[model samples]
Target chain A: MTADRPLRAGAGLKPEHHRHILESRPDIGWFEVHAENYMGAGGPPHFFLERARALYPISLHGVGLSIGSAGGMTPGHLARLKKVADRYDPFVVSEHLAWSTHEGVFLNDLLPLPYTEATLALVSRHVEEAQTVLGRPILIENPSTYLRFEGEEMAETDFLRALARRSGCGLLLDLNNVVVSAVNRSFDPLTYLDTFPVEHVGEVHLAGHAVLGDIEAPLLVDTHDRPVSPEVWGLYHRLITRLGPLPTLVEWDSNVPAWPILEAEVARADSVLRAAGEGRARAA
Target chain B: MLPLDATQQTFAHALLRPELQVPVAVAEMVGPTRERRFAVHRNNVKASLVATLAAKFPVIQRLVGEDFFEATALVFVERHPPRSPVLAEYGAAFPSFLGTFEPAVDLPYLVDVARLEWARHEAFHAADAASSSIGSLAALADDDLESVRLTLHPAATVVASAWPIVSIWTTNTLDAEVRRIGPDTPGEIALITRPDEEVFVHLLPQDADRLIAALADGAPLGEAAASVPDGFDLSTGLALLFSAGAVSGLLEGMSE
Candidate 1:
């Protein structure tokens, strides 16, 4: 998959755009899919994915692996993920750093985890297990946190860097998540990126967020329902300029718009990527 | 500091029970803003699960109004969270949960309707299998037909209900025309099959349900037809199975 040139900008694959994508064959970089949606035995999801796989490079972004859970990963879930990975041979396989299942109950949402030694060890162990099962290193995306945990611990960046070092897995740095988490926790997004170990980043994610709570003290929810916000787009430009161009994705999960609208987002990302490449070439 | 397991358990408890305070470790990070920050995670968990259930049981949601359905779904979400990561297979226990729910007792048919929807959901995701051609069966000798045991398609499911659930499901899903079902409506037996790519729901004769059920349980054709009620036409059942493309294969004498 990497035998060609570097990865390019893509969009999160939605079922509504499957036919249009196949028919139009747009110039987007690639497509990403939620691994859980394709875990079924067989159906239209698989039917469309098979055709899409033939056309573009596919990335498997999983939401429910629960890598941060202390109980360890479920065998069944791991097996199903392996089945999908083996079938698609995805160009990149990624999962969140958050845990979703606890005590046999799946919350269906990515729950936050505390940045502590215990969590680092737990997450690393889980990542190692997943890599062993999949026979390939998977990229772990930093989660968008709503709340933080109180404890003597390392910073989230240090924890993720250590996790990558220990498990030999790369990072999927979601720029929108950084913006949301920074705004929610009252931190500087640039400082967070400055301290981030961007060398380990294998991919980048850009998505939209919703502003909630009172105006005096609002919170940014990573809703992924609309176009990438201006602030998030600015962050994406800065990150790409710093780390050079990485495979970026335009994720609009909920309230997905028409084909042209989503394609427009991808085009915007592609343009930024080209500009970033030009700047790097001039500097070199 | 609480152990990792204890912290997770406490967080989960707080998410499910609003009255409970956020775990001390989690609460301290936000200071005075803890309540609002924690509510986001709580709301996301509930809202996502409720949406999942609503998608799986749309007919039930329509049968009950939107407000009632959301309320009932929230209750169900609290009582029974998903046990699997696969959202498509998340609400397997909902039909039984609806049967015991207090508010839904007045609408007894609602439980069966949920069951029918669940059946269709299952059939839609079941494994793909090629249906046995009628020519393959025609090649069999007359003497060999009775001893053959037929296998239904992997995606085929038979849901028998004491209420007219087939009509209820079709009327609500296929047509927008509102029509009230009388209390005297007869019972129904629905056969859900995904012969090719699309899932289809066909209402079968009352006796065909028993015959199909027996055949699904690995009974030979002769014995399965004999077990049906007297005057039950075996040919009709065979025709229904063939037309629906539900029969996947046939084995002689039930031997592997």
Candidate 2:
């Protein structure tokens, strides 16, 4: 198996900047790609990804396994995801701590999972099942949401902590998601950062978001289309300060800009890494 | 014990139903109003699916206009939701759905355009293959030339539409069309393939039926040629197809 760069600070490899990434060979710790996007048999996305893989440590972040669903997991989705993970051999395979598919119909969004013991137990089992199937310790990412469950019995952070403990998996702390969810829910973001079992964190994700509506009841959607917000970056600096350097990816999915702009995001993340010390890969 | 199945079912309901209050039994997340919280997810599911369709059928969206197209897509989502998580392969039957859709019936070419778009999508993601060049067959005996089975490219798609779908597709997607963009023919055959990892479109009616039929039958090159028109130049056809990375499997069939 190929070992990725030991340092952290990464970003989602945008298609728009494929040529620029290839031509300039910008310095980013590593690159993460949504597994579904590269699932196509043969295309520029896969073609360029192959080229980038040789130069960088790759992480395959999945958006679709429907891990938190009540209708059990989709075998087809798992099979497909396994096929990709085998082919790419990503250093880290991660998925959202949310459900998207129900009754065989895919919603295509990360549907929230309640922070109750039952939900936790179900999700933990699913995570372990997924990790065992994928033949690796997959990182489960906490999702950003605008909704709260009425009967949720636990905080999301605690449930995630329990999930990692039970599943023998790791955590991919999306700082922007934390900030977005915290701001949206009117919770203390620092407690989540401070209280989260930092030892379980294996990777980090930094991405741009859309500020929807008013700032008070503002739903900061994890759109991944704009520049990472100052607040979110501030959150990342906080994460680097505490969680220490981890493989962080700049995610820009929609309205993708030119390669240089994306590369700049990479550079910015690299700057954080330098400040945080080159220890993102300091053995999770 | 937390009822895992029941919580998930309730979660699904809460996500899809805009007005449905969170089931009293479900777990609490980090938010005040369950509706406001679920609203983000509702928007996400709808928006992502819509965007996936938009990405797949750019020309169709352009033809129908944004508002009408989005409405059509939302309707499609309600009627025939995606069965797969892979968005690329999600709308395989969307073109067929468009044909039966009442509002889209007026624009008969819309279905064909969708078909062509889907074909392109298939070509983009299909498997890679080392194309068997015409040279590989040049050594074949005269008998094998007509009866031997030929392989089609993994990325190749045979789309037979009654409307000038290929022209319409190219007019919108290919930037810089010298020809006037007008609905012309009732039928067109599009050969979509990704030879150099770049998706390309080829207009092929003369070679479509014989090819699709031969590939479907796995007929040897010689036998497959006999099935085509008498004047069909095997060399020229094979060369055009082979060079374009359309010939995928070309093993000689076991002699019967």
Please give each candidate's TM-score.
Answer: 0.96, 0.91
Number of backbone clashes in candidate 2: 30
Clash pairs detected, candidate 1: none
Per-prediction tally of clashes: 0, 30
Error in Å for residue A263 of model 2: 1.6
lDDT of 1 by residue, B1-256 (tens): 6778888888887887778997787744442288888899999998988888898899999989889999999889889888888899889999999999999899889888998999889988888889887777778888778789899998888889999999999999997796788889999999999888789999998878889888988988888888899988777778888879889998975554
Best-fitting candidate, scored by DockQ? 1
**Which digits, one per residue and each the tens of the lDDT, describe model 1 over residues A235-284?**
88888877778899999999999999998998899888898899989998
Question: Which residue segments of model 2 deviate by more than 4 Å?
Answer: A1-5, A278-284, B1-4, B10-35, B175-178, B181-186, B205-207, B229-236
Model 1 regions more than 4 Å off = A1-6, A281-284, B29-32, B253-256
| C-alpha-based local distance difference test score of model 1 | 0.87
- Lowest summed lDDT window (length 10), candidate 2 chain A: A1-10
Every candidate's lDDT:
0.87, 0.78
